[model samples]
Target chain A: MSNWVLKGLQSGVVTTRYPRKEEKAQGISPGFPDIDSQGGDINGREEDVCPTAALYGDSNSLKLDKGRCIHCFRCVRNTGHPVSWTSGFEWASFTEKGTPFPKIFQKSLYIRVVDSGDCGACLNEVKLLNNPLYNMHRLGLFITPTPRQADILLIVGPVTDHMKTALRKTYDAMPEPKRVMAVGSCALTGGIFSSGFTSGSGVSSLIPVDIEIPGCPPPPLAVLHGLLTLAGRTK
Target chain B: MKLQETVNQMQSRWNTELKIDLDLSAGTAVVHCERNTVPPLCGWLFNTMEYHFTGLVPEEGTEEWKLIYFFTGEADLGSIQVQTSAPLNEETFQSVSPIVHAVDWHEREAEDLFGLVFEGHPRLGDFVLHDDAWQEGLAPMRSGFDSDLAHSQRKPKSNWKPRKVLDAPGAFVMPIGPVFSGEAESSHFLLETIGEEIVRALPRLFFKYRGVEKLAEGKSIHDALLLSERFAGTTAFSHALTFCTAAEKLSGGQIPERAELLRIFFAEMERFRHHIGIIEGICSSTGLVVAASQAGILEEKMLRLTGKLTGHRYFFGLAVPGGLSRDTDDEAIKEALKEIKGILHDLNTLEKLLKKTSSFLDRLEDVGIITPQQAQDFELAGPMARGSHFCNDVRKLLPYGMYPSLQFEVPCEREGDGYARLRIFFEEARQAAAFMNQAAAMIKPGPVYTPYSGGEGTALAGVETPGGASWQWLRVDKNNRITRYRIMPPSFANWHGFHLAVEKFAFQDFPIIKATLGLSVAENDR
Candidate 1:
């Protein structure tokens, strides 16, 4: 055990100084795509090619729903010019009008992660938030066991019918003023498995959602940004 | 015994007419037999010939529903596919569960999805569909069934009727989960224990079933593959690779040599990270926080490397039907190789420390024991089977892509305990790193994506995932649209072994045993 402790020390401090300082690994994360403003007119082909229907465009303008994007990069690959990968990590937003940040949760927010029917990528990334490099607990964000003790409900996956009752019970179990942060495209817009007998379109169909963090499975940093945004710490 | 010899012996003994096509070049055989002959054939193949029952693939056509039973030999060298059809109106067939026990769940799944009647199946209850959501006599995967109409008409509330809890003198049942506080995936387990020891464990999975297989039907192979890759996060690459391999075979596309090497590279990288994640889970379960954290760091590093190379962290959108969607540059490959070397050094340090840590080993040493016979009976896959001396590594028995030339040892452990499973992970991590290095050297400059030409055909492909070998059966139309896409993930094949292994162990050791197995609910339930 002492040897294990020494080995841990030898590995040095693996924790990151995120929020206070930018992480070096942030550049590698696939963020929401940025449309090329100067290159060409919007041909609207990207809309047809997008598997999740995240991209929609007319002859002149294109719209992107980050919530619906799984970041397959088919748009970027097919168009070869109109759209490109962005380094901007912040993809969270308040869904309701005039909903102020809960000051009570500012110091220590207890999050209950609910898996309605995630494909597993989003859940893996959510688990990474507690890892040493992410160290989300240092920011007063902790994972609670049950919904009753939770301040925020972190949902991942497309809501499957089998888990619908459990997800609702979990939400109802939480105390009032609880916020639901839909993480990943599946939770946001059902991503790819949206239309099926077994899965619901998204989490919002069953419960009110405050924040939507999009990706097939968003990176840990993006997930952190979503939590902070829910707490009104980030723009 | 050779597969060809088995076919000859069956022809001599059985009265039924059989047409056996021995295509050793394809690594599979198609044995056409009458519906009445399934039981005897399965019995002979499973008991006498030492063939492991893989899965049952049911395909619905306009006229008839084709029931195909796939079985692999102990050597993993060849697979035998038995084809028997039932008319659309008369959808009943003899169950192979009585002869080969592993087919119990497979037959149940077929019954639930395709609405086929498996005569004499012990219990064909709700398999993939929810009990509350399931409409009796309604088949979801039938050829003409309208899924959109059914989904739109689904009731908002669950009709969840609880199963009867077992009771006895000092023996009561306790049910837990479907939602867990321990970050465990959505699944329920009903435990019937005597004091501190468990007598029966009934796992109620399918809470996460998104109907991935039903959703894949009628879609183009490319479109369906994205969903397949997401079937499970940890085994994304291998699942995608297997699906793509099946699609490539049906579409008659040639994968470039360079593309083949790249597939092996990505596969090895996926295996490396998954093993690390499993080891980390085991450590955390055993209260080895320091070791767990170290393993977590390694997992994170590997994920970042994969993110850097592929656009997505989980290697999504990396695979396509013909070949890869994107090509890795030589510089990136070199960089990845260097990182792998560094990971190997870190792995060596962790392994040394773990071996010296007596407390961690003590917790894992004798717990969750599975014998070689149990593994064979259940047809367990990957490292779990290897830990029980099954010698079931697909890369060695059925070499594909760069594996034919790649050098790596197929590690096996005689002791089938938690510690043995952990040791298999350690050995596999080293071998995966070595494979990555070899693939780096062998990779040559070539076009990654081969334009797919879709034609009418049926094909089957199996690729080794982190847990075990995932077998896929696909049938495509002339336009390359999938008519049928059936997947038997490794987790599905290994779940029975896991259920049996957890039985009779101390209830306190449940978490450790579960962590060591590293089975994914999504993969199993999908």
Candidate 2:
């Protein structure tokens, strides 16, 4: 026991005082694009450079949907538009359906995130609530692993064929209070690799989505915020 | 690499344009074949080549379906992919589980998601999706399936139910979790244990199989990067790395030198912490306070370093489509390196002290001795495989990131036991520190990350994760949507080796043994 305590002490305190403090690690976390005042053609350039179409175009500026971004930085890094963001870890929400992103009417609204098809990272990020680091538990936001637990069932991928039953089952499991949320671009509109035989239409084709959070795998904080918005937990 | 040659040879055997793409920076060989040839390809890789089973990603869609097979050891990267696929209507194939015992759960998962019928598979019905609504001919993985059956014209579930357990001798079974309070994603393990020995174990996963692959369909190239990253929890970057590499190759994006360095840093950071966590879990299973404490410290330190460098502790949001997310500050990283150096020194002393402890050795030595032959037959990789007399590091076999520039030794043991695993962790931990020091000291600072540009076709990226070999095979259509994205993490291939080790051992050792296998249920659940 003495040895254990001593060993732990020697390693020093390893907790991150995020949320309360500005972290340098997440320069612009949640896959947020670094917005360096771009030239007049930045919007077109961002769109031209963007592979997943996560960058939304306004008459003036190109708004990036963090949720649908895979952190590729085609618009920000590769292109000279100079919009880039660092990693930000502080993401939480009032509910699993919340959206940390601001609502934009012309900016592709009303969506649901479906696992349409994805590996488990997007879901794992959703499940980080139990962990003390991103204590999403305090926000009353917990994932059901079933669409029944969701209102705006956030979809992650382009929807694989095998998961069709599972996704349908999840949607069936959910109550009437449900609204689908296309969390990543894959769910909202199908990012890259959308034309394959296994590829499915966007989440909108499968279910009625009320919201969308476009990103590759939105930052944990970003995800929390997204869920919170769905629960109307965002102040 | 030897894998490239094997891939070249395999191409002659297969003229179906199923060439595998290679991402040398990430260290993987991906063979994206058609759905029909998946089973045979898996058998070939497991039997002929040195590859072992990693996993199968069964992506469901409302209109289409795709099941991806991921393997490691000897594969082709930096080239075209060899693929063979079939429609969802014809979802029957030979069982690779027989050839690669590690692939049983993956096969079951595929059956659960896409409704793929594995001919000759013993326990193939409803491994994960337990709904009675599952129909024999109607596969779920198809892309045309309705996202919401309630709204669909299909009739509601009627006089149908899950098959009741048969009344056999000691056939009673107990189930545990898609909702269990634990780490990783949700999953259930149904075991028929007799007197503390598991007679049979069936995995009930897919509680969160959200058609991840299906979500990639029709999306732009950039959008698939996010889809690729979410394949698994612990190793998100590795998965996305493969996708990004493939996309980079297809699109013809240039990865700057500094971006490559940062990539190596994050990968090593992920590996260092994961190893510590696994080692700690092993110690806790054996009640080794000293070792566990040492490992816990290591874990925390590594995580903190991860934060200091990339922001997120788990290194999430680090790997972008082309390069890194954020450019790690040089001085800050230098300072972190100094602190990590101190921790490494302390770890060295502590690990040495642990070897002399009898209680620790008693639980580990020969406690699950898998002979070298057995290990090879089982096709083990990562630390577990290394502990069992096999040299299976994707980094060593295929130099990726800063590995080519850095010099290191991969520790292997003849005695395939828990003791060997522990010792190897220690040695590797030291080696990790050495590598980090070398990287930090010698690594020249420059532009960190680069975004991808899609032009021609899809590519492949493979990386050596802590679990062994993690792979990603991705293809983006002309419209920038994900045509196919498949992943295989190390844990998927190691399921059999762990089960084989447990066959003779008492149930009491289940926790430690399970921990040693370190297979992530969520990873295989996809």
Candidate 3:
């Protein structure tokens, strides 16, 4: 135990002061694409070259749904219109309010993370939220194993058929006035494996999603930001 | 060569009447034989010759079903491909699972996906697909059955069935989830326990099956590379590299030396992160939360390094057919190498602390033991196999890319227990750092992508993933589109080892055993 304490002392204060201070997550996020100065239409080149069909445009203007964008950067490289990357990690929010946050959950929140049918990318990122750098507990967010104690349900994956029942049961088990947050592109719009025979297009098909954090699998910091946003701790 | 002599002896033993076509470069001997001759050949290869039966691939087209068995032979003589045919309408083949136990799951998967009847095989039931997902006679993977049509005609059937409770006085069955606590992939474990000791463990998997193989069909190999990379997120590069290796072989392109080195660098980087992640799991399972979090810091740093090297965090879209899609800058690679050295030092320190902690060691030592014979019988791979003194590392035995020239050691342990697996993880992590250093030093500037020029054919490629050997076999058409693609991940081969490991242990030991194994359900269910 002495050795353990010595080691802990040696590795001093690795925790980040997020929500209190800006955590500059530069070069860490696979940032979203911003429409460049020359960008108006996708010009048909990016629409054809994109593997996930995340890009769609005619002759007028282009729009990027972060929910569908996987950040493959094929559009940025092969498109006629100039598109650049925007490196912002704080993209989480309580997107829609089915019910207001319960009065008891104002100070602290317990979140239950469910993998409906993820590829494990989003799951890994979510787990990274508990590391020293992103110490979620320090921000008053705790991961509860049981849904009975959860104030928020964080769902990942494309919501496959096999997990539909389990996901529903988990949501039903959570206390009332709870919020549902869907993380990653797969959870929002099924990313690549959309509405297939085996997988649901998105989690909203089964459960009401209040927040959507988007990326192929959003960065860990984005997940932290999402939890904090749900807890009303983010500006 | 010894392989040549063995082939000659096999030809003589088979009465020299069967026509055998040999491709020495690919190390495959194709014999056209009647379907009845398969069982005896498998018996000879597995029972008499002691060859490791790696996988079984069954393909269906209009009239016939093509069955191929992949096996690793003695020394680097190359893998042998056993081929036969059956009518697609009434497909029936003699089951090799009776003789070779490793292919039991393979044969069951074949039965599940292709509607092939494995005569005289035990437990050839639902493995990947649920019973209600398709019709009674139609299999989704066969070319004739449309997945959309199957989905439209779906009938929901209750999957719960009566279980045979063990006949002991106090023994009872306890079922854990298809959805469990924590951030794990969904799987169901039915533990037959008496008091706290588990009598038998039945793992009912396939809760995460998304039909990745079916999704890859008819898709361009370039596009299919994305699907293969997502087959498992943690071991993304190895899976994509294996798929790309097969695709490049089919398309006939030479990967640049620099690209090969880059692939090796990414692979070792993945290994480093995965090893650290497993150590974190071990620490957490043993109630060492501080150590686990410290290891998690190392893992997150590695993830950031990967995000810098490749555009995406999981290193997706970086590996494509022919070679890598983009190249890493020398300065960035230098920085990563320097960071890796520090990470290695921290891991060493953390490992030392854990080794001294009696509580952590007490839970891990001698908890889950798989004897050497059991490891061989089950065809275990990766650190799990190596812990039992089986040198199953594909990088050393079947060298690929820069592994042929790379200097590294395959760590093996004789204890074959939880502690042994932990030691192998530490040793392999150290060796992976050494390999990362060597790859960084040896990398040179060259073109990353090579254009494909060849026509259609089938090709096989295997890579040593962080877990074990992840093999891919792809068949392309003249238009360079994938007609069929089959993957056998390391977890598919080693999941059965969990059954053997969990036997006779207390229920509390479940977490540590599982953490040490670190099996991925997505890879296996795919």
TM-score of 1: 0.96
lDDT by residue for model 1 over A31-104, one digit each (tens)?
Answer: 66675443423343422277876777742466788888876667666534446567656677778642535776
Q: What lDDT is reached at residue B108 by model 2? A: 72
Q: Sorted on DockQ, highest at the top, how do the candidates line up?
A: 1, 3, 2
lDDT of 2 by residue, B1-526 (tens): 6655676787888776575776665555567776557667777777777565555656544444555565656444322223345554566766767766667776776776566778878777655444443444345555555545622344324664334444566655656543332333345566665456666555555554445565566666555565566556467666666666666777666787777766666666666666666776777678776566566655655655665566445555567666776677788778877877777776677766676677667777767667788777766667778888787676765566667788877889888777887777777766766766677666676776565666655444667776777766566656666766666556666755565666556556666766666666556555
lDDT of 2 at B95: 72
User: Alpha carbon lDDT of residue B283, candidate 1?
Assistant: 89
True contacts kept of 1: 0.63
Pick by lDDT: 1 or 2, better one: 1
Worst 10 residues of 3 chain B by lDDT: B156-165
Count of steric clashes across candidates, in order = 1, 142, 0
DockQ of each: 0.62, 0.11, 0.56
Question: Compared with the true structure, what per-residue lDDT tens digits does model 3 show for residues B95-167?
Answer: 8878778888988898888888989898876567765444455667877766676656766455745265668
Candidate 2, TM-score vs. the true structure? 0.68
lDDT for model 3: 0.81
Considering only chain B, report the TM-score of each candidate against the true chain B.
0.95, 0.81, 0.96
**Model 3, A24-116: lDDT tens per residue?**
754568887775434534554412266766666633455667888876666665425545567878887555554336556767888888887
What do the candidate models score in CA lDDT, each in turn?
0.82, 0.59, 0.81
After superposition, the stretches of candidate 2 with alpha carbons farther than 4 Å from their true spots are A5-235, B1-92, B96-116, B131-135, B148-171, B182-184, B252-254, B285-294, B360-374, B445-451, B496-498
